[model samples]
Target chain A: MIAVLAVVQGDIGIAGLAASGILVAVAIAISLWRQLGLERSLLWASLRALVQLLFVGWVLQFVVDPDDPLIFSVIWLTAMIGFAAYTTSRRAPDVPRVLSLSIVAYAASAVVVLGVLFGFGIYDLEGRTLVPLAGMVVGNSLAATVLVSRQLLIAANEQRDLIEARLALGLTAKQAFQPHLRQALRTALVPQIESTKAVGIVFLPGAMVGLILAGVAPADAVKVQVSVMYLVLGSVATTTAVMSLGISRELFTPSQQLRRPTQRP
Target chain B: MSSLDAFELRGVDAGPAGSPILKAIDLTVPANGVTVLAGPSGAGKSTLLRLLNRLDDPLAGEIRWRDRPLIEWEPTDLRRQVAMVFQRAPIFPGSVIENLRVALPGVSDERAGHVLEHVGLDVDLLDHDAETLSGGEAQRMCVARALLTEPAVLLADEPTAALDRTARATVEDLGRSLADSGVAVIWVSHDTDQLRRLADHVIVLADGAVRATGHLDELDASDDQLVRRSVGAP
Candidate 1:
């Protein structure tokens, strides 16, 4: 565990970690001053993040070792994808087959991204690089995947008359649903695209900032950050595409009728 | 089934489970002339019209289109032969001609103009934006779009319900003319005036069941007061 702390330039001892609690204190103080009613939520979220990150950090020690079998990295990536899919389904329970569709989206994006990074020799084929890169890809794509799924469901429910009108005109479900699917995909992808466009100017991204804080040269950090940004964008696009198309298919019957989504209980 | 029948329903039950909107409905829609489905709101007139085009299916029993079971016909093919026009007249975001092209893609300008004319719309309105049309014109345009498929039957679910009096008359005339042209017009109307003017044959529905089926003259002469009142019979 100490070696894990040493992987970064300097170890943040227990005292340093406690000292960082001042930031949370400031956020809580602001919430209290504003009467925002977010004091309990802020406290709970901070504690939750601390425990979750520490657990992840402890687990990464064995897996992130370069000497460990690459299988460990693959297993870690699989678990992350599974959890992402589960979270997406939980967020959008109204979407039919969301769990399976999300799995396809996350798994496909992971393969495309990691394959490009390693196969193209952009990053070394080791658990140390593979785990973090795949983690970034999955974590970044999870929100977008959920957005695409829920957006399509919203489109189907809200524009049902329009869809049925198209269906009544003899258009197949796929043809009738194409416009809404495109709209949902656009709605899901735009946030990520805008974030990518404004990455360095508007706000420094977390990965690049973390690297710079760990004493990496700014130029080298920029190179890694640019690659990571591109991969995140690519992964988001791929995941949303898979999710929108797959969910669109599920929203219809084989007879080309749009299946009305049942109201969530 | 009579050869002149367009749709034949036997023991049909419909609507969401446990609360059917149509129940044990045995009826036949004629292959020619206007057949108005006259009922109060929630009487399942729209639901019955939806069944004719396979927009919906009965929970029980069978529907036959032109003597063939509805389940046996491909849904898209069925819809092509039996097109529907909705009440709100949902206009796709495009020109009038573009909306028509949705029913028959690659529709020529001449054919588009002809269908528009058939619906009493001006040929010049072809290039006009569909979303900008008045309520009457939009409903007429929807009728023209359905006509592009050259359907044998037109299921109009209260097609003029949202229109002003003049617009309602125009769409009513369109329905009458379409039926005169040998397209079986299955019209749903709650307006008794529209019923008196347009119903060549009437099916009166109440509480999700058929209360009467006959001509206005015969229904007016019925012993049942409800049947007489449903058709607005004097």
Candidate 2:
């Protein structure tokens, strides 16, 4: 199938890569015409992605084979999860020890979801299966974590008076936070749900389209895409739910009283 | 109704340890009459009310209710027994009746209407939206909500400050009625006129400690500057 796609689409050699410059020039042109002042950021982001992907491809030369040792797969995926967590927690400043917390979230979600896949014999626990699967889980979980944690802090701060008022009315800490937790979960999950809802109709998803272009049958491609979508959704929901519960618990002291360390002035 | 007869705070220091807002506060809130806590700004009057409900624990010392330490009492149980009405009325997003029913489950519409009447609000306002209420109306709504809990003691922090003179008079009468009905009314007020008119017992606080405690007339004769300044005695 790879050979067929390479024959049909032609090799994406160095010259072909140079041809992609036209897209960048178009972006630069729009940036100039609109005076958006985003030319620098756009240029930097494009260059960074180029360097990062090329380096990843070079590194994959040594590790892409499923025959590679499982130890290498575990170590590599752990590093990827660490980086994903760091990036996600950066967006949620109010979350205490956010980096460590995100690590726990991403690792746990990836483990359970990947374990289920392994149990089903979909892929062995090696780099070929582990890297891509972990990528899907970690990347998608980052988005959900950022949304959930940000909304959690925002709700806690914006609704402190209401929450404390509930607490004042003889409700426990968890009961007082029920509304805020509900709001956070709703906000975090809606985007993923919407994308899944519109998956093929609004736009052909990247994974399915790629697989079809690579000469997999259209039905086969669709099945693989559906599986990926379900797996990613499950991973994200688990990450968000776990983190939300933990963060809500953090909002209270050991004595079950609210601790407003993140109260906005 | 419960065996708890009063709130006892013995050397009950609160706030942050280094600079406590309420320091060594030894007093008892007996389950009767109006015990008015009076002070100038920053005297920790609101903190005292919060302590009664275990909103925050003291930095040191103990607050007991019914001879049991407040920390030992379940917070929910304690709060139900010691209901609080904030200064701004804590008007939330809901209908008036929903606000009333949030704290007290299964509060019948008739009972709700009765409490609103006691707070000088018409039962017709039951369907009125909480956000649309006037300041006085919101305060009254909160009071009616607190009353539904059938609190053994009501701790109000400037509950009538938002009310107009007529509304304030009505709430004052309501407080008197609550006291008469055997609810211990612990009203925190800076308004000397209100204190003089309403307080059966006055606690004058200054620098986060009680400067004086006695009858209103007796506090008016106190020589301490905290008492003299707060009571406004010439």
Q: Best by DockQ, which number? A: 1
Q: For candidate 2, lDDT tens digit of each residue in A98-216?
A: 77778888888987899887778765556766787888998888888999898888777777777778888888899888888988988888999999999888999987888776677
In candidate 2 the C-alpha lDDT for residue A80 amounts to 89
Clash list (residue pairs), candidate 2: none
Docking class of 2: medium
lDDT for B95 (candidate 2):
90
lDDT of 2 by residue, B1-234 (tens): 443677788998887657789988898766678889888898888888888888888888898888899999889888888888888778766799888878876888899999999888999998889999887778778878887877888988888987899778877888888888888899999888888888888888887988888887787787776787787665
TM-scores for all candidates? 0.93, 0.91
Ten-residue region with minimum lDDT total, candidate 1 chain A: A1-10
DockQ of candidate model 1:
0.70
Report the C-alpha displacement of residue B8, candidate 1, in angstroms: 1.5
Give me the candidate number with maximum TM-score.
1
Looking at model 1, residue B173 earns an lDDT score of 92
Would candidate 1 be rated incorrect, acceptable, medium or high by CAPRI criteria? medium
**Runs of candidate 1 exceeding 4 Å displacement:** A1-13, A32-40, A263-265, B1-5
- All candidates: TM-score of chain A: 0.92, 0.89
